[model samples]
Target: MTEAELQQLIFDGLRKIAPESDPASLRPDQKIRETLDIDSFDFLNFLIALDERLRVEIPEADYGKLNTLDGMVRYLLAKLPK
Candidate 1:
């Protein structure tokens, strides 16, 4: 998928984790936890949802590096097929 498409997927999945969040309005650089209030469970759900969509397993240890939307996008980009 394209970067923008990946970004949208992450946004959509995260928005679902925090139903009240306005993912569309969030800036690309915004931190998912601080800005979107995504707790540990929500983060795990996000990882699971993304993994399902991308058909890859995102290790739990790597999840710590994805504390922000941008970070997550970067991580996905690295994991996704080039």
Candidate 2:
């Protein structure tokens, strides 16, 4: 998927976890948890939702790389099947 598409997927996952959050207002370089008030459960759910939607496996060790929007796109781009 293209970078823009990956970003949109991430935003979609975030919205699923935090419906009250405005994904467009989130800073790409900032931590998503802090930006969206995403608790541990929300974060996990977001990851699960993304994994299911994207058909990508996000290992627990790499979860830290998904903290920011930019990071999430980069990480997913690398992890996605070529």
Candidate 3:
């Protein structure tokens, strides 16, 4: 899938998991933890859900790389099927 498609999916998933999230205002450059007030458990759940949906296993070490929305998109794009 294209980067935009991946991003859109991520946004949709986030909104599905986090009903309070304002998907429209989610900026790619923004820090997800800070901007979304996401705790460790929520972050882990996000990754796990994404992995299950995409059928890709994200490395645990790569969690730090997903601090921002753009970073998450890049990581997912690299791991997910095109």
The 10-residue segment of model 3 with minimum total lDDT is 15-24
| The candidate that achieves the highest lDDT relative to the unseen native structure | 2
State which candidate, 2 or 3, has the greater TM-score.
2
Residue 13 lDDT, candidate 2, scale 0-100: 80
TM-score for each model: 0.86, 0.92, 0.87
Pairing residues by index, what is the TM-score of model 3?
0.87
Candidate 1 residue lDDT tens string, 1-82: 8989998887789778998988877776777687887777877777788888999777777867787677778888888888
Instruction: Rank the candidate models, highest TM-score first.
Output: 2, 3, 1
lDDT (10s digit) by residue, model 3, range 1-82: 8988888878877776678978658787888778877778877888888888889888888888888879988888888766
How many steric clashes does model 1 contain?
0
Q: After superposing candidate 1, which stretches have Cα over 4 Å from the reference?
A: none
The residue pairs found clashing in candidate 3 are 1-82
In angstroms, give how far residue 6 of model 1 lies from its true place. 0.3
Alpha-carbon error at 79 in model 3, in Å?
A: 1.5
Clashing pairs in 2: none
